[model samples]
Target: MQTIETVVNVTSERQITVQLPPDIPTGEYDIVIVINESVKSEKLAGEKKIKTLKFSAYPVGLVADNFTFRREDLYDR
Candidate 1:
C-alpha cells in the first residue's frame, strides 16, 4: 500500500481529479484525500478547517453507487 498526495491552486476549478489505473494489483487499499487548508466549515480549533474523506475502492470488481442497497426494491430473487 502507498499514499499519494495532491495539491490544487486556490482559483478557477480548485478541484483535484483522480483516476484508477488500468492495471490494478491483487490486494485491498484505500485512498485518503485530505484538504488541510479549507475554510468550508465551522472551526472550533483556531480557525483551521479539516475535511477528511476515507474512501474504499476495490481493485478489480463491480462498483456500486451506494455502499448499502435495499434488495427488496431492486431484486426479486
Candidate 2:
C-alpha cells in the first residue's frame, strides 16, 4: 500500500482530476478520498460576507419583576 498527497482544483462541473506518478504502475486499486472542511470553509469565506450579530439584552416584563436568580434554585430539592 502507498499514499500520495496532492491538491487539485475542482472544475465547474464538480469534477476532480488527479495525475498519479509514473512510478505507480497502471493497475486496479482501492482509492480513498478525504476532503478537508477547513480548506473548503476558507474558500467560501472569500466568496461570501457573513453578517455579524449584535448581542442585546431581552426586553423587560418577560419574567416577574421580583424574580431573582440563585444557584440553589437549579437543583432538585
CA lDDT of every candidate: 0.60, 0.85
Top of the candidates by lDDT: 2
Q: Tell me each candidate's TM-score.
A: 0.25, 0.56
Native-vs-model 2 lDDT? 0.85
Summing lDDT over every window of 10 consecutive residues in candidate 1, give the lowest-scoring window.
37-46
lDDT by residue (1-77, candidate 2, tens digit) is: 88998887999998999999899999899999998888888888888887789999876663776666776765767
Q: After superposition, how far is residue 57 of candidate 2 from its true place, in Å?
A: 10
Q: After superposition, how far is residue 9 of candidate 1 from its true place, in Å?
A: 5.6
Residue-level lDDT of model 1, residues 1-77, one tens digit each, is 56655544456777655655557666777667677754334344457656679899768744565644678757887
lDDT of 1: 0.60
- Model 2 stretches with alpha carbons more than 4 Å out: 56-77
RMSD of each: 21.2, 4.0
Best-matching candidate per TM-score: 2
lDDT of 1 at 24: 61
